[model samples]
Target: MASLAASLRDPAYVFHFLTPSFWSFLIGVVAAGSSLFFLALRADEQGEHFATSHNRDQINEAIRAMPEVVASPKRLADEANQGRNELIRQSHEKHARAQRAWARSQRYKVGWAASLTISALAFVLGYAWPLAQLSFFGAKLLP
Candidate 1:
């Protein structure tokens, strides 16, 4: 209780940012959170680490995409039927891929969530020190 109060009263003790302002800890939280979000986004976009993405793209390109050398359908009905089938298949494949990506991203999202929760707790503790003494808690929790 005294040290934080003293630091607040004495400008010299509170000069450094990392010591009190927690810039370094905040930076780590940002960096780690950004990386986790990126990984999650990447997974959601394309399951590069999994076979699902490769196969899905390949099938979509092969069957759904119109080729340069196009052929006229003997009957309009044939083209319509093929197009409908392709659309259905593509939608199913996309949904499956999305599910896989979402499952894969669970861990990253949880890690980021945990980091934020801990950071918030630490922030409270850092500011609450000068108001109340919790040496018993601090002794075990803080360095």
Candidate 2:
């Protein structure tokens, strides 16, 4: 019984039994977490891209509609020139708004890309730091 107890307490045997499963579980968790994080980032990017594209389409439609608004000829001859000038001003305003929207979309793309890169780096480092440790001369050293 004493020998059985001593044999069961051996560190090498214990480590041999536990190490593979421990590392496997750790790696699996890291991989799954990284995959999920990346998927979320991709979903966010797609959503933003879709929204920006939709907004641009709407702006283009509005710009197209500006011509129709100016095509009405039911005004006095004298007022027609003033109406045309006002329509031109509105078209310029629409163009400015579209430019601003494009700039905002570009900013969003840059920010999202930066954030995704940082998050992926952090995840990789967190997983690798633990696995990169060296066991030598009865000491575990982080590499």
TM-score of each: 0.37, 0.44
Model 2: residues with Cα > 4 Å off, grouped in runs: 1-79, 135-143
Consecutive 10-residue window with the lowest summed lDDT within model 1? 134-143
lDDT of 1 by residue, 55-85 (tens): 6666666665654333566465556567656
Assess the local accuracy of residue 85 in candidate 2 as a C-alpha lDDT between 0 and 100.
60
On TM-score, the leading prediction is 2
Relative to the true structure, candidate 2 reaches a TM of 0.44
lDDT of 2 at 46: 59
Show where candidate 1 strays beyond 4 Å.
1-9, 14-100, 133-143
Give all candidates' CA lDDT scores: 0.56, 0.53
Q: Provide the lDDT at 57 for model 2.
A: 64
**Candidate 1 local lDDT, residue 142:** 32
lDDT of 2 by residue, 29-132 (tens): 66556555555655665566566556656655665564443344556543645655655566566556656655655665565566556556655654454445
After TM-score superposition, the amount by which residue 31's alpha carbon in candidate 1 deviates from its true location, in angstroms, is 7.2
